[model samples]
Target: MSFVGKKYKLDKSENFDEYMKELGVGLVTRKMGNSLSPTVEVTLEGDTYTLTTTSTFKTSAISFKLGVEFDEETLDGRNVKSIITLDGNKLTQEQKGDKPTTIVREFTDNELITTLTIGNVKCVRVYKAV
Candidate 1:
């Protein structure tokens, strides 16, 4: 098994806060982000892999292989499902039936960068091991 794990302390930056708010996340989630200590784990087994996120507010698991489509509800419970494709070390995901929502992920310098896009709005969250 090839895996990388990191615990990140999150500060609800203005951009992220605004984005989540716009997505209709409740006040609790917004408050949770302020005091969130999230752990992210990535495991790679051949072309199939799993990514997990755990925190006080939410826990989510995603499993996919390269160039596969998976239906996933957004954190806000929106019906934005995506198909993920790996391009080298970066991941590109586009909503299957919705063109307005997209996500991209990249790992570098022991940090994980994830960008979420909804329509014309884009929000980025950065995490590093504690």
Candidate 2:
């Protein structure tokens, strides 16, 4: 039913480097991001949700409520205002900053698929439950 309490490990990524480039990420950071496999854990507590992404480089934990806007510092070191909305099994996030982007995460068949859209670039990342 819910995607909470599950841990998903990054399986593969498509066009991730291009997407990071669109976000103005530097060469070194892009290479680091591309080389690392991150594990994402989603936890729900009433109306609040925590999404934790952990990798060899770093771990990022974000906590927010549905429809509430919060400040976020992206992995690439960009600060933005982000809001996440849940629709059925899909969670969509809009980050407002100098370079706005949209992220959509959908859970299906025990897989969490994420789509990142920035300008004309789109990247898909697949994660499998672990």
Candidate 3:
């Protein structure tokens, strides 16, 4: 219930590399990195949650539960199947598909910090609740 109706942002500096790596990329992707700033809005209600990610590049939306599997895509257009579970105060999103990635989000310093990994590159993005 506490997690319901809460919002967060990505801490780009600390999470970018991790995110991309999880998406299945190597140094090549990092070398050709694009300047992207993604923001996420989360609304957890009852047994389901709605999450939205938006940036200059693309926007994605996801709705799922603790054990439910759902489909999602990255800003660069990578498809994935995702399932989110709670680990203490953090939420871990385990993604499956052609690109496997894991994203972790937690509340820190009054902001939401997210980390992503594709292959070798990692990235972090941060957002403040609005």
TM for every model, in the order presented, reads: 0.78, 0.97, 0.70
Worst 10 residues of 2 by lDDT: 1-10
For candidate 3, give the lDDT of residue 51.
77
Q: Flag regions of model 1 displaced more than 4 Å.
A: 1-14, 96-99
Q: Candidate 1 — what's its lDDT?
A: 0.68
Q: Model 1: number of clashes?
A: 0
lDDT of 2 by residue, 67-105 (tens): 999999998888999999999999999999999999999
Q: Write the per-residue lDDT of candidate 1 for residues 6-39, one digit (tens) a residue.
A: 4443423336776676667788887776567577
RMSD (CA, Å), each prediction = 3.0, 0.8, 3.7
**Residue 129 accuracy (lDDT) in model 2:** 92
Worst 10-residue lDDT window for candidate 1 reads 1-10
Query: Candidate 2: where is the Cα deviation over 4 Å?
Result: none
| Residue 1 alpha-carbon offset, candidate 3, angstroms | 5.5
Tens-digit lDDT track for model 3 on 55-113?
Answer: 66567778888878887775556787888988776888887877667778776546787
Better of 1 and 2 by lDDT: 2
What TM-score does candidate 1 reach? 0.78
